[model samples]
Target chain A: MLLDLLNKLVSARYPLRPPGAVKEDAFLQKCIRCRRCEEACPYDSIKMAHGDWGLKMGTPFIYPTAVPCYLCSDWPCINACPTGALEAVGEKENVKMGEAAIDETTCFAYNGIICRACYERCPIYTVAITLKEELYPVVHKEHCVGCGICEQVCPTDPKSIVVFSAHR
Target chain B: MTRFELHFYKHLNRYRRLIQILSVLFIFIVPLLNKAGMHAIIGTFYSVSIGQLDIVDPALVLQNLLLTKEIHFPLLLAGIIPLVITLFFGKVFCSWICPFNLLAEFADKLRKKIRPKTIRAKNQNAKPQYYWLVFGSIISVAAVSGIPVITLTSMPGLISGQVADLIFYGAVGMELSIVLLILLLEVFFWPRFWCKYACPVGAVLALLRGKNTLAIQYDAHICANNCPVNLKKVSLCNAACPLQLNPRQKGIYPYCYNCGACIEACFNKGGKSIWFTFHPQETKTNKSGS
Candidate 1:
């Protein structure tokens, strides 16, 4: 059946999230199944899969060969995910691949101490985290990898720098 | 002339319930809740080249956004009410209003057919680890685009008769196994889990939901003696939230969508303290849950 071919094509390229992740099947069912993921994909790899198998419901999948995973921060695709189907998670790289949170209180903005520890230390070297005229450190989530590095280096006790992981 | 009714206002819960009722109306009462307000505009502009419709979504808006330079007025309102509701009510919409939410719960109905006993929600606040792949990819793309591209990917199209379209056009001899699998997952795993965590709109709303908006209130005295944390997290209502809100929080958790199922569930438990605030007289004394 064509469904068989479709499944094989997808499986060969990308693997599904590990088992035990049907966080909300009911929620996924109602999704209108638009291809928002395609637009958000920095790599232009995501495609609206053939609905023949009905596997391509509301969630969008990546077809690596066409584009491959271009790991942009914030994963606008995750942010665009209307259902939990495209769940969010923080990577270990501590490289922010998404928006970073700034605790205004402890943020260097209020810390009275000048430091762009995150901006300077970022591994991607794009200055994803920026200092707002010596104000609080604003995170360009697009560059953040959810690696908790900013959070780790935050001098504030409350930890002004933090990433909202699994937030996509 | 009349004195302000603010004195009598439960303040928070009033707007909370109003948000809930409004979301319900948006979802259920609307002609096509999923595709409401999307067709006429996007149809003329996008003209999806699908079946007979020949509608192309991106083309319609992209052309408009680029050429006309005038904002597609409707696009401004796209997911506005729902998004605003999430900011105010902590995603109560997921539980009460969204038809998909209702269907998600109904899918669980299949569960009842299988087992008379209900499987309770446990560990409601477990940090989602799987999101790494999901959020990771999305963030990667956003970084490159410098725009919220997910807007185009997620958030189902709200075209009219979309359900029928899925049946006739979408379901045409499609894999029954995938459909059944999604159904099985909905019935067994987190019922409305997708709406709870993965919804990009919901996430955006939550980011801005830290305020005095209307939200579920778990009064310490009442919740300690009568909270429903047993079913899941800190409270019964919290556990039921498709968005996984912490009912015990003093103010809105930003993710709360104001869905009233939690209110209904709490009412079922015979808790009088749980009140839906809507100014004054409108406060419905729960005949039954929280």
Candidate 2:
């Protein structure tokens, strides 16, 4: 009786499961621990970290708190994903939460070549880009807000930087 | 006691499998729609014994969706229905429902085409070393990564995705080539070998199979003596289980999923009332007759 009452109360309080909020532990348990998703992430924000949940080792993660989600129009991660672990499509609002990354070696600004086009063209340039006095501009990852503007503007043969979103 | 109650029970008995199948269809089919708009309707959390948790807890497939969020009633049921079926029968889901199982079977044909003639490794005593290797390193890695890396990088998934991508991109000319490669790899070698050895999902399921509330039972007279796994006479029950578990085992583990593959197998063998019990030890029935 008590359990029943408690169940009822819990349901009333937290009725909504915020679609796609299902725990993926069971599926993660089935995962073979490959790095395909990591390579597929346009943001390059995915990393393999096995901690706390010893059972969920070598899985993909995007620490959005460390970075920010930059919505990629064409998600390579979805295209590249093989297992159902990563759904081909997902929520747009949630997808916007994935973080982005930049490789300084490929950034035109790193070569003492002034390429602030990414910063100027970025939708969130103010939050996603920062100017460094060293050579051209140094991107502060903390404040850089991985929007992929740098990646898109990057004149390198093939864009050498990317970002990622938390694929929860 | 009442006629209405008896009638209801009869109907229930007949439609029970139908209900289960419908539930599974509802589960997988609905979530598929979530992909169309990338607007999921389902939430992540579900109520478990240990309070509330993510519906796709473990995030293997949902994480792959990569949409903002999704509503997937079909997916939830599709996933949970297998467990439900196991609780009542014996890993029937593996034989009938699993898309992966179907894929593996499809690949089996292709694998056979190019499969190298092999020296059947003497069927030796299997060891627990593979289990340790599985849980110790691979599982730990998945836990840390918050995703199942095992199947993602799998050659099969990669190959399939490549073929699908080629088709999706309208590279019509490339489709035949990719299909041929996939078919050759899948049919020529071994049928469902990936599930037996490579599939962690299979591993998890095998562990849970014996615990099934419903499962297969042994009949001594069928083979006139030898066990089903003796792999000689063809029997439906033995052939049904995706794991290829011997239906004639003593006191099967309690984790078995009640897929009725064995029952169907027995039916083909001219067995009777094979599916007599809904749960373990509920009824003592000799379907093959005295």
Candidate 3:
């Protein structure tokens, strides 16, 4: 439909939404773009989408490489959302911002560099990421909340481990 | 002007400027307070919370209702406060509280200063219906596309949001450029263009005015009988209006935000022809030429 095409055209990038964000379509519909979530984040992890984001301008997103969500236990961002674009989940661990994937070709650990940066930095270490044969770090996608702490801490120059947006 | 009237009218604009400046400062102060571990008051103009009370933009709430196809009671409740204010006060938010309006006023002054010979064009003042048309188009586009498009264009929301962003993140986003671009156009080309003809936020607020709402009332008899100024030329009230509206006419009420600039101008010009009154019936003047 024409509406779908317009939505697609305006949504320039599927940037990682903040914790407790609803589905992208619903989020767009409900979000009034108040920037309350941005103000609530203690780590300043939430950022307002700017002009480059097309119609998504004023909506909140997180560029985890620069400042990853610390994933506060209280979910202040969700509490700050007045429009219900961000709903309160039962547990912080249940937050599914996106899923993380590691590129074997660029990964230092895969290239025998023995990097444990991502595994060590993972908030849900044992569940989200595991040691493969006691050397490689393997991501369990279902368990990974995609907070992007691993991407922030990745030793690789281009970030071997990246969190892809849940919607994408 | 009498000594007492002079004293009073001089302070009217001074009070307005104080409120305008305070609102601008409020945006930055809230973020700084939030950073200092305070959570009592928060958010930008799009929506804000002062303790347990959530005050949201009525236009955004309307957009949300259209796009989501549901009634959100909390947001609806939050939106009512502004609607009630606009219902009684007649878009005072634009003149007294909107930071963008303060910036636009400065831009209008600068435009006059840079080009002193600039003449007021007849077409400069857009018809009120055009503002409604723009508002309707925005709402329709938002409903169809399932996007809150007004949030992208709302100037007050953008200004407050960017201010918070600057305070928290230590840098403003590219969205500030949109404001800058509008201001550039305001300075160089059209004066009071966005608020008069384009802003959906103002359009919605202005439409909420009732017959009893605070509005600028003009006494034609005072101007026709008592005024020494030439009626053929631009009167002081018309000259004082930032939106270039003829305050003497009732038709211009929709475009008027009860800024009282013209009222102050009339007082300064030694004529109490124009003033704000909630009860328009008591101050009803003769149906003469505007």
Q: Pick the candidate with the highest DockQ.
A: 3
Worst 10-residue stretch by lDDT in candidate 3 chain A? A1-10
**2 or 3: which has the higher lDDT?**
3
- Total backbone collisions for each predicted model: 74, 127, 0
The candidate, 1 or 2, that scores higher on lDDT is 1
DockQ class, candidate 2: incorrect
Binned by DockQ into CAPRI classes (incorrect, acceptable, medium, high), candidate 1 is: incorrect
lDDT of 3 by residue, B1-290 (tens): 47765676756788799999899889989999988978778899999988878999998888888888888788889998999999999999999999999999998899999977664533234566777788788888877766677888899999998888788778888989999999999888887889887888988898798889997878887778887677566567777788887776656667888888888877776777777778875444344444
Candidate 2's TM-score: 0.45
Consecutive 10-residue window with the lowest summed lDDT within model 1 chain B? B41-50
Give DockQ: model 1. Answer: 0.03
The full ranking of all candidates by DockQ, starting with the best, is 3, 2, 1
Give the DockQ-based CAPRI class for model 3: medium
Model 2, residue A81: C-alpha shift (Å): 14
Please list the residue runs of candidate 2 whose C-alpha ends up more than 4 Å from where it truly belongs after superposition: A1-116, A126-142, A154-168, B1-36, B41-54, B57-93, B106-193, B209-212, B218-246, B249-259, B268-270, B282-290
- Comparing only chain B with the true structure, the TM-scores of all models are 0.52, 0.48, 0.92
Candidate 1 local lDDT, A1-168, one digit each (tens):
333344355443322211112232222332234443443344444444444423434344433223334445565555444333354554534422234577776676565777776666555455567666755566776665544445556666776765553223
What is the lDDT ranking, best to worst? 3, 1, 2
Interface RMSD of candidate number 1: 15.0
Native-to-model Cα distance after best TM-score fit, residue B214 in candidate 1, in Å: 2.6
